[model samples]
Every structure is written in structure tokens, then in C-alpha cells.
Target: TFKYVDTDHDGVMVKGELAAVFDYLDVDHDGKLSYAEYTKYDGASAESQLTHDVFNHFDTNKDGFLQRTEYVDTLFSQMDHNGDGQVTRHDYDHFFTNVVHHEMHQGHNGR
Candidate 1:
């Protein structure tokens, strides 16, 4: 999943590489995502509230659009749970499986 998100193959996930994921989520192809568009993203699933919160957290500029840097930073921060500046497989899996899944299930009621 990390490889897929890191579209640039730059050996590290950067703002540019994260644009691929943003593009995928921006279903309207408007170059920016509104709250409605974000909710519709496939990754959103039943965790619409958490997804919404995540989006807001990443919209650092507060312009209601998630710029590339914000998106990349948000994802990297989440993946690097220990704040050790490196995302180990254990950290990645913990965030992916536990954090994301927990949020998703919370919204879906264990759908």
C-alpha cells in the first residue's frame, strides 16, 4: 500500500508522490477536494467521520483543500506513530490495521 501511494518511486513518500492518492480521492477531478468529495473516497468506507476529521487535520492552510504537503505529512505522521522519524513495518501495520480499522468500524458499527 505504501508503494502504491508513493507513486514517484522516490524511495520516500513526498508531497508529489502523495498526489496520486489525492487524485484518486478527488472523484470530481476538480484538483481540490471538498468535504463531500472526501466522504466519497473509497478509503473513507464507513469511517466517514474519522475520514472527515483526517481531511480537516491535513488541510493545514485551512482553505478547505488538502495541499500535497499536508496530505503527505498527515500520512507520514500517522504511519510514524513512534515519532522516531522512521516508519517501521510494525508501525505501518499498527496504524493501518488498528487505527484505520478502528475508526472505520466506529462509523460503521462493525458493518
Candidate 2:
């Protein structure tokens, strides 16, 4: 998956990697994500308040759609820790490790 993120094979990650993610997620390739495209679950997912909250969290532009930059920038905020616009492997590892660690220590094991 790192290779997928490292599209340039340069060992560093820029917003382009996240751009690819946005593209893959843009089911219709319309350059933006609709509510359904973003939270595709059962018939009620798109109408759920939690889904709306999550979608609005990433729709920073308040445009009712998830723009590519909006999606990428939202994630990049956590990945690009040094403000250099590039996420090294270390950054990737640290980010996920912390995420996993948080979940692991959140009191639930495996249900």
C-alpha cells in the first residue's frame, strides 16, 4: 500500500498520493465526492447524522461536496507533521502506529 501511496517511487509522499486516493474514491470520476460516494453503507448511511458529520468534517469549503483538495488537505494535516508538504516513511509509520495504539488502548480488545 505504501507503494500505491508512493506513486512516484521517490520514497516521499506528497498530496498527489492522497489525490490518487480521492480519484479512486470518486466512483463516477466526477472530481468530487457526493455523500453517497463517501459513505456507502446500507440505504440509511447517507442520511445518518454521523455520516453527515463525517462528510462535513472533510468538506472544509462548506460546498456540500468533497473536493479533491479538501479531502487530501484534511488527511495531509495529520500526515505532514513538519509542514514541509512531504510525508516521509517515518511520518507514515508514526501516524498509523499512534492510531493503532490509540485504538488498542481504548478499552476494547476484539469485542
Candidate 3:
């Protein structure tokens, strides 16, 4: 999935690549991602509601919208577990397997 997201094949996820990802998730082509857009990956089920809450957690500015900068920064920070300032495939895998799973579990538990 990391390689898939790295459309530029640049070994690291740059802001532009991350923006493209956000655009894909936005669905509506709007500049910001609403809860519906953010949670659309799993359809309009309960899981999507949980995912929406997770998206809100990423909205650090509390603006009720996910700006490109916020999405990129949150993704990079989560994936860059080693603090190397780069999100390699290894980091992405680690993040997807560990952080995402943990977050999902927490969400399921209503944390």
C-alpha cells in the first residue's frame, strides 16, 4: 500500500503524493474532507462511523475539516515511527500493522 500511495516512486511520501491520497479519499473533490468523505472507504456502516471518529482525531486544528497540510503531517508523523522524517515502506508497514490496528481496536472499544 505504501508503494501504491507513492505514485512518484520517491521512496518517501511527499506532500504532493499525500495530497493525491487525500483527494482520493475526499471523493467529492472538495478541498476539505468531511466525516462522510473520510469514512466512505467502508461505506456508511458502523465501522465507517468509527473511522470518521479516527479522522476527527487527525484533524488537529479542530476546524471540522481536514486540510491537506493536516492530512500530510498526521500521516507522516504516524508513519515515521523512527523519527527519521521519512516514511519508507518499512515505516508504512509498521504504521499500518501496528498503529492502525491499535487505533481500530481502540475505536472498537469506544476509547
Count clashing residue pairs per candidate: 0, 0, 0
lDDT score, residue 5, model 1? 59
Candidate 3 positional error at 96, Å:
2.0
TM-score: which candidate is best?
3
Query: Who is ahead in TM-score, 2 or 3?
Result: 3
Q: Residue 76 in model 2: shift from native, Å? A: 1.1
lDDT of 2 by residue, 2-86 (tens): 5667888899989978787678778998889988777752343776654575567678789889998787887677778889999
RMSD of 3: 3.5
Worst lDDT run of 10 residues, candidate 1, spans 9-18
Higher-ranked by TM-score: 1 or 3: 3
Error of 3 at 24 (Å): 5.0
Would you give me the overall lDDT of model 3?
0.74
**Cα TM-score of candidate 3:** 0.65
**In order, what lDDT does every prediction score?**
0.67, 0.74, 0.74
Q: Model 1: per-residue lDDT, tens digit, 21-107?
A: 777877777777777666665545545566665676568789988765566677777777767766655666788789877766674
| TM-scores for the candidates | 0.50, 0.57, 0.65
Candidate 1 achieves a global lDDT of: 0.67
Tell me the spans in candidate 2 whose CA falls farther than 4 Å from its real position: 32-67, 100-111
